[model samples]
Target chain A: MLDEIDRQLLQSYQRDFPLVHDPFGEIGRCLGIEEDEVITRYQRLKDDGYISRIGPLLNHTKVGVSTLAAISVPAAMIDSTAGMINSYEEVNHNYLREHHYNFWFVVAAKDNERVDAVIQEIERKSGTDALVLPMVKSFYIDLGFKLWQSTQAD
Target chain B: MVTDQDIIRIMQAGLPLCPEPYASIAASLELDEAELLRRIDAMLRQGTIRRIGLVPNHYRIGYRYNAMTVWALDEDRIDAVGELFGAQASVSHCYKRPSYPPGWPYNLFAMVHGRGLDEINDKIAALKKLIGDDCRQSDVLFSEKILKKTGIRLKNRSSEHA
Candidate 1:
């Protein structure tokens, strides 16, 4: 159960966090709280797993290349196939989904060639044909969750 | 122009959680605090960095039911349908991808998160009503497990392609 302050912090700081010498101090000013309190709350949120991290969400398209890849693996071979795919540093997001092409992962690399190379390597090692689905157009992309609303039904 | 490598190295590790976070990072990179800020500002303007802030773990925050819903729509209506799905508050990511005929026929993908499958299904029903007959078929692929999740890391300059 989160208090109003925790909810406020989670909601307000999801994007456009102050870029200042003392950002927490700035946040403290905004919320009419002390700087130390802001830091403590942030630490608590992270410790409690409510928040993953405080950082920049880099645009891989500008910094590197990436693709969403999927492959169909038998139930008996799911574990081993996932292991093989996860071995690549380029593979950032790996998930098991309820579909024929169950194993899905996102691979990011410095360039397209490298992205394809990593995909090929994964396919070779896993012995599963992988479908590479790069985003043709992104209609929307925002990861922020409304914690205030999320906790309301409870 | 400052290279992407410099920015990636600083950002991949994550922004420091301190009173003077950017200043601390600038000192290590031997960059003036103002210049570092300016570079980051430029990146923001250019869409290199999507956002700089706290990212919550939705699962931990009670959004346990996560599903990647894919829709097969009439090719001509993709942009319109994409806009409709993308505008929903529950939809986090919406994109257009190529559809492999016969086996894979979903072109528009949207990820919806909620407290339970019922909540997500409600959203899907709303989507179905909005899309009408334009949506040929759709399926929800619920995530069973997360094997890995990490920020992208760049290779050394020597190995980087020109």
Candidate 2:
């Protein structure tokens, strides 16, 4: 577990990783640590699954289009169905929601029609019907957690 | 450990191109290359920075379809249902959001994205079969516009305007 110093460092960086040339060096100066140490610790965190990904945050709407799609699958065949859906590279993330349509997942395709084609392919393969509800409006929330505020319990 | 100035410079300029970009950035700040490297490493270790890489552009690659799928689940079996739904690859952002009246029985929410409406429909059909008749209702909320797109800054910047 991270101590106070470690916690402070995490809180600082959780917002956004620097995009500078020598970000490590710059951050190190602030935190008073060696660049290699930061690199090593981050590597360890990622290896341990604490960090999900280290990549760009691209805009979805700007490119072409993207939608949030969902499907309901039988309990027995959920495993098989999910495996089939996951096979597509376009489908990046998936989830199992708690409801009658228990099995819901997302599919990022090249276009609206392409999204439909992939859904059709899933239907043909999984034999499950999906209700395609696209997003008309969306809300944004600052999901960032404040360690200082949250740490009051401790 | 990095100074606030370093972060400001990066956020202002955004991610740079070319190899050994950090070295160039260090030169501009009048900091040693070794020092810059060390600070970045420390910051990442401490969680001051999550990562240093390219964030993907989902729309550019042709993932146009997006929708919010809500499902009606039996209260007693929600745990089991959640496990099942969590296993799917298509569901990126999944959660149990609060429900409202007007016969809004569906309490489970999942995000589904694809190329178009048809692809999402097909998946929904398959999902219906897999989930059995346990779900009494389901609905999809399609996205119609692109509202806002940007990264979240960690610094405590004023947002009185927002």
lDDT of all predictions: 0.83, 0.56
Candidate 2 C-alpha lDDT tens digits along A29-76:
777888777666655545454443343333344333455455777778
Clash pairs detected, candidate 1: none
DockQ of predicted candidate 2? 0.06
Each candidate's chain B TM-score? 0.90, 0.69
Q: Which digits, one per residue and each the tens of the lDDT, describe model 1 over residues B79-156?
A: 998887788787888999999977899999998888888998997788788878898889999999888887666665
Question: Which ranges of candidate 2 are over 4 A from the true structure?
Answer: A142-154, B1-162
Q: Model 2: per-residue lDDT, tens digit, B99-139?
A: 44344566677666676678778766766676887787888
- lDDT for each residue of candidate 1 in A4-108, tens digit (9 for 90 to 100): 788878888888888877889999998889999998899888889988888778887887789999998889998888788888878989999999989989999
TM-scores of the candidates, chain A only:
0.91, 0.81
User: Residue B103's C-alpha lDDT in candidate 2?
Assistant: 41
**Lowest lDDT 10-mer window, candidate 2 chain A?**
A137-146
